[model samples]
Target chain A: MSNAERPDGWAITSPRSDRVRMIASLSGRSARRKLGMFRAEGPQAVRSLLEHRAADVRELYLTDAGTAANPDLLALAAAAGRRIRRIPEDVLRAMVRSGNDAPAGATGSGADGPVSPQGVLALAAMPEPGLDDVLEGLPHGPLTLLVLHEVQDPGNVGTLIRAADASGAAAVIATAGTADVWAPKTVRSAAGSLFHLPVVTGIDPERLLPALAEHSISALATSGYAAQDLYDAELPERSAWLLGNEGHGLPDAVLQAADLAVRIPLAGSAESLNVAIAATVCLFETMRRRGGGAAR
Target chain B: MSNAERPDGWAITSPRSDRVRMIASLSGRSARRKLGMFRAEGPQAVRSLLEHRAADVRELYLTDAGTAANPDLLALAAAAGRRIRRIPEDVLRAMVRSGNDAPAGATGSGADGPVSPQGVLALAAMPEPGLDDVLEGLPHGPLTLLVLHEVQDPGNVGTLIRAADASGAAAVIATAGTADVWAPKTVRSAAGSLFHLPVVTGIDPERLLPALAEHSISALATSGYAAQDLYDAELPERSAWLLGNEGHGLPDAVLQAADLAVRIPLAGSAESLNVAIAATVCLFETMRRRGGGAAR
Candidate 1:
């Protein structure tokens, strides 16, 4: 919900006004870059940001006329010490992105578009995922990682991240040129997985992959036409799953740079799979291998 | 696509007229149901209908300019022995649905929306799918089958069917009240899979599963909540994959009807997997088992 003015304290009212027309225009990558801020909507999204970094949050909004008076959101906001602003009901309706439209074509009435609700839409600083090294020796969790490269669609990016979360991946690396996972739609499509997983953005694997040569992590990139079948590859104890553009798939440059390039075998007449579907297949395949008793 | 009409012929030009008004209100499922027709836009989608006898043959339109020049489409229309009506250009633009709207989090200038192309919108009769007895003896091939029980999302239905085509599934069966797999969005999302796959709709599993049983085809439903894991399940020598509703999964009635309800194990935070994902996992797992080795 961009377009809201920043009132002095933590409260925001009637957000998404023409006053913040810049934020709406910031739907462009160029604009998001200019502001160093992006938008995220819905109760779940706002709550995820609060749980992670309350200090980074600036303003919060709730609908006037007792819209978001529910105890759960209130408890979360109160616990985070975030003040709430009262906005007109109509104000909150326009704050959502279109894909939030009806759950990806769930129904005919287009209920997935933005809904009017009394909820908190907050502004939080972008996450700092730190260096790649942050994942090293992270307890006893599954040693999984999602490496993204120049993926263009925010929905696919978000969905991929969501799959990664479901499959227990530890982090996502958004190489330069990929959609920003924090951009509102990607964040929303991710269904709050953005906060659950560590995301490293603006990476140039041209430079980053070389630095990990010493680690035991197997660097595998997904390609539709790769020579090595995904099921046959010797998966690493810990992994780095590299994905690239939806149509182009992995660039030869990146594929050559990776430790190995693997592909999910197909049995159909269709040319290729959707970017998100491909990512999920690769991510879950790794998970299957690990749980099936592959000695990691 | 809707306004233009010429029953029993192939489309020629990419017309922009007439069909524009028809699709706006016809955007939802109820409207489509009332009309007894659905929208089909884009060259890929148009080509698909020409290729398949799966649906009833009906009206076809093409822009005068795009009609005369595109020999390949002309050849296809001729092969199908259908007539083509040409329309205006402006009407064509308004008819195409704009998909690929940047999802919520991505900061991008453009958003994907509904696609209703003006070039060639067909008013085709929905196909009456294969009966239980007709499908009992599936022809020889890779032999993949999609079974749905009340899957509500037309888009997901469309997408899964498209994936079935891409992954090479042989036929798709939709249980009672699931989204019409042949509806415009499902057709569009399917990326022409309906042409290649025998989509048997209005399928009541009580009648069909038993038929499949008589044919010695094991029917396995994908269950994230089930006790038997997919990797561990003994997939059939020949089988059908059953996918359930997006909200409530396959009914216990149907699950009990199935020879086995196999679970797709998850190691991550998602309490449940999407129906499409779960189905794809089940299908691929079948392929894995068919490849001659037990999966770990």
Candidate 2:
């Protein structure tokens, strides 16, 4: 709201103060798709880019005050041989959506002409598709991959990413129907996984299956009432854990394409697990098989 | 917002629409201080209440049309033995905070309110604490009580409670600083755990220490850089798991008060685990110790 005063190298004053645009456009996968980039706010996200050496980063935008508040963010971009741009509050506020409402009106990534310009947003390349990499790309043998089939909530998608990242999964592959992992909320919910790991979105399961079959892996889908528990099954090393849409879950077609459906064990009366938690159970089970459970 | 024909009952309306003396007092714990009560609007929160069987469900206020669309809600309340009331739509819309910028004295739950109230809400009672069963006389056997200190996110609080419930721990105690497990968001996140189990808020660790000392269960604090990994530690049956705040983590006093500080192993660059996830890892570890791992 006030006139911006930033560092020497960056220009702080706005050319048009009253007529600022907010980029809530990052809310939609399509919008993200058009621009080939997404929004990243907060100190954690900024630090993640530095930690992972994110290859897609074209710009590092921040508030001059944000730079003053979060020196770690400044250190991050600087250490990575990147510059931090001091952006406007109106732009940042426009791009960011609080937990108040799920972002809406995602017509396309670049469909609209400058919907909003936030304090900091990036134009980065989409993570490349490598389904085979998901199956066998880790340092050890038989890596695990989390395959999300139309899981709609960005928060759920992001949480799953965070959990998957924590378990040291090979990668996360999202079908075209799943919520965009790069959406601002999903990215925020993912904490920093988006920066540290591979997140391939907008592919069809039809296209993904053959590549997975080539890797000699099994796709284990999670069902609410299936008899066996996720931990009960003899989890394999090269396994793809699939979590479906929230209400309908995976359609018959998606499940028919997978190896088997497993259930997370429930002792109580919960009709279901949150999609993120369900995915986490599946992922950790694989990690457990991979000796992630062994003492450090 | 249209009104549906109401049955021969009292005035059917939206509580949010009735612009009366609304207490937007979220400043301290006082407004929330009154246990067994809070406000929320949204499809998800309402659905969670229907599922949870919370006992103090004092009233069900709704516009006649809301009742028609979500008849399941009516059936659920009846099944739960709750009372329902219906109101007008214009009144209800007026009750809602239209935009994020809800001015004080607007008589609505906005910004902090849940998104989308389907013309209905229920005032439910916070379940009676189950400390009576767990700490009835401070048993001599091994006991593990989990304590959450100032975890601010309502969802995180709820998830932690779910983890506590899932692990079958004796009870979950919250310090004065922790988030409210009974808040609508927390309840939704807990997935009805609040009804089936005990989440005691506003307690002093000092009070619990003396109470549990009889059981000889030492406190195990968790920190990112602790000396030992939780998986490798020799956990006792009578231990207490202490998890701290999300942003700031556990305060110094809470950690210092603990018998030991342990860390979950991390092989990846994730800065930290979700507090709830970290607690689950620890609880499941304990469950495994108690030989529940054989269930798999």
Candidate 3:
């Protein structure tokens, strides 16, 4: 085996190096857009990126500990003929953006030590899946699409993406006001689900509603005050589950535009479910009605 | 009106006062235990605490903005014979611990501004509900209990508590190693559900399992790899849904002790669901089988 192929060779040790700073810049929305790349940090996300979207990965870095811990991931990347560079702890830490993985109120490398990226970081070309293309590719069966209408929390967006993937949704459509799907916090919270399905972002509601109508997909608005109970309603064969902002729910116009406003039954005194939880319940209920896990 | 009853007659303006520092220390686990008090920050949590558990609240503080924003809350507190004090923004900020209310990486009042507590904060004696008393009070009909087995994230713990309340669970029990139920982050994430149901913490599995049996409440372990599908299984009328740690999952011995092992069906390529999502799915499924929204 070549020395270059060994885990310890070709280390990047400087925290302030130009290349490390350039990679770290991907944490911000503008930098990602300018560079045409987004970052996937932590072991689970990087492993998924390598396994599912290996060709799109522009660069991969791992700390010495990261390399030792993820032998299988290294093997997978190597098999995919991807280059992996070993970086020092500081460099890896430098590339990590303060996000969901670190506890809140945690400042830079204080008593709790450095904020970790879980040993792996990957920069990949952001996949831009258009709504038209996503609609065109649907199979001839009951299909589900998860829509985020101005859901601003990055962590909630990421969790919703994972829920959409778990429930076998065809795609995730994020409105313009939604948190950047590529934000570091979203990527960390997504836990590798981003690589599993088509994610369309930055589309306006005006554009999306017409597109759904054109595609013959029913738009179901989830609300706490709706008259229709989700369980009692007859769900459409193909539908888009619309979840709105965390504080203010879907606006009146949007709710009116939807084919139906469905409310998840809150059995107790809770005024509403967390937007992410509400979305998951809706998606999973669709799965249950169509068929059980076997249908997936 | 008396000077004390008015919102702005007396104010706390100093962030470094002994009172502010003492309240700030409640953020630590040891301080909370030692003082037998925990904090509820932000408008929603404070409102819920006052409306639902007014007697338990020892003190309440609100900024000018908070008072202006929540006139109805003030009336509720007054009606309940609770004292409400006005504090300046700096003092309010000082009393808030580094928690979920603040975004990650936000250092002490840096470029993005101070970590806000959403204009209000409260200190309350923690409610210590016993497992035996909770079990004995269950209705004769179907009942649900949510169990967190060493789930460590404060945000996830809080979200799970909210989900349990939404699903009409009888109580939420946190085993040893779970996040502090009264931590600021958990309370914030819970949104207000903490006041709606009994939450028992610092429990051990050895004690929990026997307690469930005595109550004839089936213990259902939720796992990603369980043989029995959640939708397909014949669920018990009374049961405790067991959710394990984020990284390690439920210990094997606990899984063995469970009356049944249940798995939520994942239709997509994702290997598992988030712990909060998994617990919600299970709790909601119980509600679904018994009836729909009317069951509550």
Candidate 4:
């Protein structure tokens, strides 16, 4: 398509341009809601979006260095028929708050910022899959789902998503008061796992409980002080693990609603594990129990 | 003693002062090496230093608000006979590169800086506990130790320390090329767990392997491609789990030196787990095997 005909074909050079401002504003909830779009920065995240959810990617922006370094990703984006725009490094830097100058070769993981300027970024349509849609599309047998309640830290939210994906969880549900999973930091920390499965956000636990029951998914709330140890609990074949906020943990009402309340036993001086770590331990334990063969 | 007579009793008011420069410079390797000291920032880290290693706390600085909020820590410092000085918040901010204006009540955990200025900071002597000393001081019965080889992120290092503490690991040893465990960010991420266990730095694996052999601690190196799954491996009563850098697995030599190589079996599309999360899984598995009761 000719540059004039393509909607996203403008070469963005000015950091102060409206397009840059709009892309940068994806960090905020209102901006994401108004724009109906969110950003995935660096090669890994952008590549994952293009690879898994190509139809959702609206535009791809690349600098000379980013293009040179990510030829395969460019090819994938082209195959997926995404509009590509060339952007300057300064413009790319302005699109994110921190780590804009990270080395181009970095894997976009374990770095300082949520969005590293790895020379490439993408503006993707928010895939607001409905809870019923996700429930209807569940994989055949022994399903694992993760429910995040009031987990406010973006890094923790992202890490949990990545962990959930790694543990073979079918989908993730973020209840009200949770951090925005579409936030740049959350996208980066997820390390591209966000695109791997269905994620439903802005959910209410009250509505979710009955829906989960309809789906035959037992909700297990994780608590630090629960009398039932994690190992002793018989995790169901179809389970939804409820992880809570880092500081206050699951509210008493939510704990009461869960089919079972389980705790990861602590053996040392640390009072508790980081929520993400705790979630991974629980998810993997469930995976292990369902004959996923991780233990073998 | 009078303020003039006390070696560390100077009230710092200027951010540009030499004392502030020295404290700020602790972020650098050469500065830490030359001064033989590192910084512990925020109230939790500072309080831990005073409580556990009072002799290592050379000096403590606190703002009026900090002193007021942390009365117990102040009394502990006084009881430990460490030098204490009062400073302005601006002066405290000048001592750290970031989060100088963090709210006085914030836990100083999620602020936008490597080091959060919690109105309190301390310069503590680097307690380079000898390998023999750590071995001799090990708690009776089965022991767990964490050995970090070349892991370069300060946050990861700190989280690993906290995880190690939570898993009941007796101590942690950071090999060369690893992020400095004494760095301010590491201290903050550790959340005072550094005080709960002995940490040894700059130890060569060649020497450590022999020392571990002498102590009958089996070395288990973690890798992503290992044929032996973590769940199936027989964890020894006394074990040293070696975790490598974020980007790279353990060096071939280090992996070869290990008594056994094991991998955490991942079931999803995630190629690998975060190093801290991986370490936690391995450490807890070891705990589970040694009757630490995580699985019981």
The best candidate by lDDT is: 3
Give candidate 2 regions above 4 Å deviation. A1-9, A15-30, A68-76, A87-123, A130-140, A293-296, B1-10, B14-36, B39-55, B62-81, B87-113, B117-120, B128-134, B137-144, B289-296
On the 0 to 100 scale, the lDDT of residue A39 in model 4 is 88
**Residue B97 in model 4: lDDT:** 54
* Residue B148 of model 1, lDDT score: 80
DockQ-based CAPRI category assigned to the predicted complex of candidate 3: medium
Model 3 C-alpha lDDT versus the unseen true structure: 0.82
Worst 10 residues of 1 chain B by lDDT: B102-111
State each candidate's clash count: 49, 26, 0, 0
Q: What's the lDDT for residue B155 in model 3?
A: 76
Q: Model 2, range B1-296, lDDT digits (tens) per residue?
A: 11233356445344443222132222113444554355544444566667765456665667767777887777777777666666566555544432332332321112133334567755555555644455674445655578888788776787777766666666778887777665545665675566655567787766766665655778888988788777668887688898888778887876877888887665456778777777777776676456442221
Arrange candidates by lDDT, descending: 3, 4, 1, 2
Candidate 1 lDDT, A1-296, residue by residue in tens: 22134433333244465634544443446656776666656666666677766676666666643433544656666777776665555555555433233323333323133333335466566776665565563445348788888898776787788788777787778888898776665766776677776778888877668645545566888776777777777877777888888658888888888887877777665556777677777787778877732322
| RMSD, candidate 3, Å | 3.1
Q: Which lDDT tens digits does candidate 1 get at residues B59-161?
A: 5657765665555666777677776665566555544433232222232212234543535666676665566544755775345678888887666787788
DockQ-superior candidate, 2 or 4: 4
Candidates arranged by DockQ, highest first:
3, 4, 1, 2
* Candidate 4 residue lDDT tens string, A1-296: 22225444448768888878778777677878999999898888988898889999988888878978988876787688776787778888888742222222222124444435589899999999999999998966688999999998887898899889878898999998899899877887798889988999999999998999998999998877788888777888889999999768889999999998887877776766778878888888887676554311
Candidate 2 residue-wise lDDT at B122 = 56
Local accuracy of candidate 4 as per-residue lDDT tens digits, B65-170: 7877888876787689876788888888778753222222222114234544567889988888888899877766688899999998887898899889877888
**TM-score, candidate number 3:** 0.94
